[model samples]
Target: MPDECVILADGPAALVELCGISTLERLLRTLQRCGITRAIILSSSAAEIARRLARPSWARADLEFTIHERPPGPTTVQQIVDLWPEAAARLLLIQGDVVFDIRLLRTLLAQTSSAMLIDSSAPETNRGKLCGAALLQREWAVARNGSVESALLEGLEQHTAEALDVANQPLYDPGLRRNLRPICFPAPALANKQAAERVLFDSVQKGTLDFPAWIHAPIEKFLLRYLCRTSITPNQLTISWAIAACLTTIFFATGHLIWGIVLALVVGILDGLDGKQARLKVETTAGGKIEHHLDSFFDVVWPIALAFHFYSSGRLPTAFYYLVVLLAGEGVDGIAKAIIYSGAGRLMTRSICATHRRPAKYLHLGVGHRADSWSAGKGSNCDGVVGIDDCCNRHSASSTDVDLAPKNTLVDQLTINPVGLVLGCADRFDEAVYHNVVFERHAELALEAAAYALFHYLQNKRLGNAGAAILSQNAERNETHCANFATIVEQLD
Candidate 1:
């Protein structure tokens, strides 16, 4: 049980920034989260690092951060022992470049004896490549005179070392062996940057809508990593994209089709970036609220503007009527979604009941009527019992149970499926739903755009113009799509 952690934050790698935060800052934050009250940061330029960390934004009032200049020759363990003799009894060693999960670190610290954190999933030869973190007892660090890895290996050989299985944990090692770059770093900083982007990417939520955009994920991730080094906030990005979307609408209205298409594509990419940046930076809820409203505004206004443009050009006569239909469909969609989420509590209760029923089946198969005996009067009466008393009790208990049952409150409901429950406290079911709905809406808009493009294509034909007929057919198709979505709402009702 380490009372304090010693971070070896010496080298260019320690200064590497991710999501606008330095590796040392990230490490300190993780240690704070793990409830480590004290830490000593050993760096070659201790004063410079300490000065940089003195900013009000980087302040951690609870944890005491001390910086020490790294000695010229001795190993990190040996230096720690020579400098802070008291911390030798229970010292936690962390390599400054390694980006890891706080939960994993806390789990490692829970061990009773000295332990080395290893990724078991790595190849047998690579398994010895520890993730730059280890728990060492006091005696283990005394007079150690090599690299941290070498010292850890010697300690393991000399003592009964417990290997902390970090195979499934989110541990990013940017050491000599496992250098995850491009996604984690730019071309120049590939060797030095901590693999924080890899950890952040792993943390990204995959929603129902995520599959359609899977092709663009790598591009978005690349751009996100690049943008993270900049001082731009996520909300600022959202505002910029909103302005671009508005410009896109203007371009469509002015009949600049190429500019409109280009801006629309840019808007789409920025839309993805805003959310990605927000999640990575842990932006405020107000930022997300602003994003949602902007998206909703764009979703309705963009198509309406395009339709108006077509009507003004004498391409489609019933554009206003089509706009009306679109608005009505969107209203119906909103109402339907609200109703569905409202009933989620009842559905969740039934789901829980179903889950509880499985064990009773197993118990019945194993113990027969004896299971019934224990459950007879205790309100566990499921079905098919043969006594008059049981029948009477079942009937009489049903009403009382219904009356006494916990109310199906909205708070108890989970909007997403059971698999989403695995996210536990980090579950953003509403956010997922919003993203899915936006994707579906975007798909509808794409279909409409295709229809408009087809109308133009037909009008340009040398022999005959079938633009009116094509537009009419597209209008009917759009209506059909709306009706199909409405039918889903009806079914849910």
Candidate 2:
């Protein structure tokens, strides 16, 4: 509703120093409290704050807020336009030096014009006047490829004649124009529009307003361009990133917290880049999937192992038990995937002729759920039922069960026991994270089977000599930890 606004506080420490500590703090608090929908602040300090506050967000919608640390020069305007070309809305450009009564902000919001304010203190007394504040109209700027700054200059140049209609014709002349007009404000003046501008000027004179590290942002873009080249493969990049993650984890675990944290940060950055690089490079493969799986697998193990090592050294049983349950859950989940896929294959070969045949069989065999057969009158078919589709079931045996299914006899086709499926699912869940949607949709049923299997295995493992036959039977039934391929092959055959 208020359009797009940028609070451009461009100046050396002088402008910042002018406002002093109290003034800067007030400005930060006020700007944050300001109800503007999109606020852009050009400051290194702002960037630091934003980074420090970054966290995983599950927002229904995303809002873009950018803070640019403008380099010294008149060209700072160009930098802003480059950042947001399509945001042709209004802009509130606040100079670092100009402090104002909150009312001035209210008045600026109300104005429809491309406007600037006349600092009540003219510092004709000073070297440069307060050309700091401006109410920018998007349409007025030169939008050469949507450059808002150019649009601002263009609009200002074109609309200079119209400036006299708004405020103080006597104080601000077109002769004072460089693409903006000055709007005069009266005091009891709730803010520092006067001293603030001077601070900015002084900082500029001192040269403390250094260029930002934002140049790294374009590094992603550049890598994006490199990605356009036909050389890199996503799997390779993923493997590289995985190696980096492993190294980072090792470093962090081995008495090097600072270096490890730094490496961890790099790991995070590269972790983000690997995917982006993959997208940019247009490379995707089964190996990419393998890489993803490995990444997630390590993500679960390494962190917990680190915590375990730390806790174990301190003799903390609580952490050990908690991590054990988590590891148990992960193992359960992984094995569950293998079982579900295997069972899915078996059911596909069924002769149910009924509409609910396949997934009904899957659900039954999956978690030991009773047959949920659809009535013949129901319009839905087996195809509509989820988690039991032929593709998934058929594919299962190809990967996990290929080696094991052949030598063994098919004990029961379309077996409605969900025990294996349940155990497999439970085995694969690492204990660190829980209840994520990705797990819910993909891992739950499998985990159920895994939990069942681990229990069965542990029971056999416990019985020692007496349970030898049971252990052998269990081992023969499930040779691999994950047997999805076996399931797929069995179903297909």
Candidate 3:
């Protein structure tokens, strides 16, 4: 909420590019996110830097930039002070030699009284250094002592991720213990851009990931390094994947199911990349809202397209595909996620559904449960039905049918909540990651669709929220190894 900011863009590293944006622009964006609408930048080439900053942001139409020519020092600082608005209550001082995490600025801005940003990391060995940024009283003159109250920077030295620090650190209440911890910083030096880029890219990853996202991460980042350098914007990246996903309709309608599925999976990778790039570049916009509608559009379109294909082929159980498309597709599930998240304040979780009892006998078929597969049958369709082997036998193929897929098939995994199979199967090392969602078996397929509805329709569903759930069968499915998002849970309680 700081309205006025003075950024020292004349510094040695100010104009240097890190991950396609200059250090100065990164400083401005940090201000942008903090709602600092008025900025005065100090740089010898101020006009040039200002020209590069005309890019659009959804929340930043009110943001204004002005430039003063000089290497910032006493003279330039005084000029900025003279030009500072008379009615402004405070001015935020910033150094433009490094890239900062926005959470760091938020921590600073949340302060009730102005204080200088301190490098409290090595206070013992460090004699003193100048403040990196500060919120100052607008009626400013050089402090005779050049002194400002120090707000302590607190976080575990062992923690490297900025988000972990931002999310996990506790700020105790007091006039002063009220201070929140700042997150990561990497100087934008020529020798350091690669490491800075890595740190920035890694910062955008969520605390939790599904099996698919975890497996896809390496390739995603590998491609992102080049894509970030291109002129293609995040919205364009979003549009590109959406168009590619829409083409899946063509593939499915034309009897090119393999291409359709392949393109669909690859679209998942692009979908993730667009979000990362948007965060990395701080380019949140109305286009982001568009991304969601496009996602919903494709989510419905692709399934309908598949239904069209199945219907045209005159296949058995074509009605089932239509039911799945109409019922389990995007819009309803997305609404479920929003409602659950709002009520529980728990993200990346599922709604209760299809409460059917598993046939305890064929548990290996993902009908029965494992120890980690936490729950009593949900109170819906699953409320009373247990030991459904009679039903399984009535509908399912022989368990030993060799014509069907082996346990690792991807289609079976996708169709049903494969957590049980993956947990119990000996072949499950990467089976959780690589299994297909459908099977080749003629008769067993019926049970797969039914169980998926009975189990995964809303039960323990983990799609969307950009894979914010870690996809575990246990009650701890929302938890992660590093307790990365432990911050939110603690704050709520």
**Candidate closest to the true structure, highest lDDT:** 1
Estimate the TM-score of every prediction.
Answer: 0.47, 0.27, 0.58
Clashes (backbone N, CA, C under 3 Å), per candidate, total 1, 58, 13
Using alpha carbons, what is the TM-score of model 1?
0.47
Name the better of 1 and 3 by lDDT: 1
- lDDT score, residue 386, model 2? 13
Given candidate 1, what's the lDDT at residue 383?
15
Score each candidate by Cα lDDT.
0.51, 0.38, 0.49
Candidate 2: 10-residue stretch with minimal lDDT: 433-442
The residue-by-residue lDDT of candidate 3 on 130-199, one tens digit each, is 3366656554333312222222121112111011123222222111112333345546567877888887
lDDT of 2: 0.38
Per-residue alpha-carbon lDDT of model 2 for 144-202, expressed as tens digits?
33333444344445543112122222211111111122232221133664444333222
How high is the lDDT of residue 413 in model 2? 29
The weakest ten consecutive residues by lDDT in model 3 span: 484-493
Model 1 per-residue lDDT at 42: 84
Alpha carbon lDDT at 483, candidate 2:
15
Model 3 RMSD, rounded to 1 decimal = 19.2
**Model 3 Cα shift for residue 112 (angstroms):** 2.9
Residue pairs in candidate 1 whose N, alpha carbon or C atoms collide under 3 angstroms: 88-138
Better by lDDT, candidate 2 or 1: 1
**TM-score, cand. 3 vs. native:** 0.58
